[model samples]
Target: MTITAVWPISSEQDPNAGDSMTITDPGEIETLVSRLSESTAGAATVWHEGRELADTDTQMHDHDVMALVAEGYGYLSYIDADHDYAVLDGDPASPAWNGEDVDFPKGSGVSPETLAEALREFLDSGERPESVEWQPAEW
Candidate 1:
């Protein structure tokens, strides 16, 4: 299955809208991570076989993310076929989501490197990453 990463174009009026790039190789993960790390507006959604790795409820889907909203820190969370998971790391944080700040529980914050690794695993497996410790998302 092909995995694609989609992120909002900073130029767009809606933060929830943007384009997608197919992750054909591992090297491309750096580019995606860089985009997320460099801009507070940065966020991305991972998709496998054209189905977004998001919750079934559309209202909550915007919160699903792998984003670096603060320098050297970020969060990774998504709902795959099996379960919804958030990376277990630092304290609870509010990261920008769809142009608004959304609260992530404690242990959700992760480093950019960790985020990149999760993305790599997702790209490789086309499923929720098994690379980092995950806890059921509190929300």
Candidate 2:
């Protein structure tokens, strides 16, 4: 659950792009996680002492991303601060990675050329390839 707040900042009209939210109760997180895990989608819930926030172990990196994609679990990955996309490697058993640079969600069985075309199209709304059947977490 997200807490919404509207603080009147006379000097600013809009909130900062990067906003920091404080979650005071650890039990709320557990409750939310439990509710989300009941869905049909694959679920991974982790619990840690509420001593710190954003630990390295919970954060995924390059190789970690490969593993996640290969596992065929649907996930929205934030590749970087400015670039984010959903990726699920075609053939979960193989480490095949293909997706657009911007926000294309590519799944397993997407050809490399098709993936490139999707990325190119995302850049400028260009023509999409006939074979690029890009979908979000369809696998």
Candidate 3:
């Protein structure tokens, strides 16, 4: 199946932040999913459509994820990737604009980039690209 992930552009600050993706066959997806679960250090409730999938063994399908929000966090990037797995931080002047590597609390705030990655990993089963692409939100 051709799985797809979409990340919308943000006018906010933070230039270091962006979205990316890649494709993985079923076998690769399974392997990546395992890695993701193993890599899952903190905690989150995986979701399919709108239903929360508490079971780790639940096969991944094309879906949306609000892992951190479900876990009771504030933002996406700061919460997941940037905090720990995140490689860069954006400038403070224009957080979403300057793309600077500003030091920040680990796993606390959510950067758009990190949020996009987390969602990508969840949906693409960890397969990813350099940045996530998004469309206009209806609501």
Best by TM-score: 1
lDDT of 3 by residue, 1-139 (tens): 2333222223347533333223344344333233223322222333323323334486543333322221222222312222233322322232221112222233333443454454555454433223532222111
Candidate 2 positional error at 54, Å: 22
Q: Which is better, 2 or 3, measured by lDDT? A: 3
Model 2 vs. true fold: TM = 0.22
- Candidate 3 segments exceeding 4 Å error: 1-46, 49-107, 126-139
Span of ten consecutive residues with least summed lDDT in model 2: 61-70
Which candidate tops lDDT?
1
Q: Model 1, 1-139: lDDT tens per residue?
A: 4566666666656665566677778888888777666553455666655444255665333224444445457677675446765545554553433334234565567777777888888777766777777776554
What are the per-residue Cα lDDT tens digits for candidate 2 across 1-139? 1221111121235443221122234334333223322332122212222212334786532211111112322222222233333343443333333333223233343433333333333223212223333233322
List the candidates' TM-scores in order.
0.67, 0.22, 0.22
lDDT of candidates 1 onward, in order = 0.61, 0.28, 0.32
The local distance difference test score of model 1 is 0.61
